[model samples]
Target: MSGAAPMRVLANATELIELLAGEGALPLVDVATRIGVPRPSIYRLCEGLAAVGMVELLPDSRVRLSTRWLALADAARAGMLEWRGAPEVLAHLVERTGQTAYLSVPYGSSALCVDWCQGRAIDVLAYRPGSMMPLHVGAAGRTFAAYGVPLPEGDRRRRTEKTIIDYDELAADRERIRRDGYALSEEDVTIGIGAVGVPILAPDGTLRGALSLGGLVEDIRKHCDEFVAELRAGVERLSGV
Candidate 1:
C-alpha cells in the first residue's frame, strides 16, 4: 500500500536487464545518468549482471551486453523458415563483384568472420567463417574499430610501414571512417589484398558488425570507385533488412 513499496517493485532485476540490453554498451556514468540511479547502484547492478554472464565489463570499465544474447538470436534464426535466405545475400554480392565478401562481428580483441562468400575468380588469400582478424588490421576490423570499439594494445605496437600505428593517428582514421561511412585499407594486412569495409549498425545505432570485400589490389584499383559504391550499396541494403 506504500509508495516506497511501489518504487522498489519498479526497480527489479528485469528492469535493470532491460535497460542495459536496450542501451547496448554503456559506461557506468552514462548508465547511471540514463537510469536516474546513483553510480554505486548502477555498478552493483552491473556486477550482478556480469556474474550471471548477461553483461560483461570491458577493460575500460564499460559494461556491454554479452555473447549470451547471441544464443537466443541463433535460436531464433534456426526457427525462422525463411532464414535460409541469409547466405544468398552474401552470395549475390560475391557473384556481382567477383571478390571475396565477408561478414564479421567483433569478438573480444578481434573481428570473427561469421559468414563469407568467395568469388569464382581464384585468389591466393581466402577467408572462411570463424577466421579471426586482429582489430587493428584490415577493413572489417577497422570498420568495427572506427565505431568506438577498443583496439588491442599489442596490435598497436606492430606498425606496418604504411599503416597508422600511433593511437592519435588511429583515432583520426576512425573519425574519418565514421564520417566517410566506410573503411579502405591497401596492404594494411596482406601484401596483395586490398579491402573495402562498411559497418553494419543495428536499428538502435549500435555496431552489429561489418561487411567487407577483399580482392587483389590491382583488380580493386581498376574498379576502385565502383567497388566502394557497390560495397556501400550492399551494406545499405543489408542494414535495411
Candidate 2:
C-alpha cells in the first residue's frame, strides 16, 4: 500500500506537468479543479515538483513549469539520432519558403513537434515544440498516416469546419497524400492558416518523421508548389544525416 501511494502521486505529478505544458501557468486551485484532484494533494504535488526543479511556485500563487524542462526537452531532441540534422533543415526551409517550418515524428496516433523555426510572417500558435497533433488533423500528422503510421481509431475532433472528421473523407485524403507524395492542409488545424508536409522516409520506405511548412492560407495556397519544392529539398538534406 505504501509503494502504491507513491506511484499514484508520481502519476498525478505527470498529469500536472502535462497540464502546465499545455495551459501555461495557473493558480493551484484551478490546477486542482482541472485535474480533478483535491487541493491538498495538488499543493503537495506542486511542492514536490518545485523541490525537484520540475516546476516553480510563483509569487502570485500560480505554478508554472521550470526552465529546467527546456534543457530536458533539448536533451530529448538530441537523443533522436535520426533527426540530428533536423534543425538545419528546418532553418533552411524557413529561409527559402518564408513560412514556419517544423520537424515532427509519430507519437502513437499523433504527430509530435520536436523542433520548429518561425518565419518572418504571422506566428502560428496552433503548434509548437512539445505539442502533439492528431494524425487526421494536420499536414504533418496526415503525412505520417499517408506514409505508413496508423491513423487513430474512433471519432476525430474537428478543429475547424475544414477539418476532415469523416472516416471516408479522411481515408480519401490519405490516399491523395500518398499519391501526391505530400500532404496539404488548408485551414484544417487553424482557420486562416495552411500547411504542407512530406514524409521523411528511410531507404526501405519506413517513415522516419515529417517535414512541414505553415503560414497564412493565402500565402500557402499561392506558393504551395514552391513550398513543396523547398520542403522536399530540405527532406533530402535530412535524409543524408
Q: Rate the local accuracy (lDDT) of all candidates.
A: 0.74, 0.89
Predict model 2's lDDT versus the native.
0.89
Q: 1-241, model 1: which lDDT tens digit per residue?
A: 9988557645745556555553467777887776677788778778887898988988887888788867865675456443244466678788789988887788766777776788766666535554566677788888889997888776353435656687888888899999998888777776777878888787788987887888887877787677778776777677656
* TM-score of candidate 2 on Cα atoms, chains taken together: 0.83
Which ten contiguous residues of candidate 2 have the minimum total lDDT? Answer: 148-157
**Candidate 2: where are CA atoms >4 Å away?**
2-8, 25-43, 57-63
Per-candidate RMSD vs. true structure?
A: 10.2, 2.9
Best-matching candidate per lDDT: 2
TM-score of each: 0.62, 0.83
- How many clashes show up per model? 0, 0
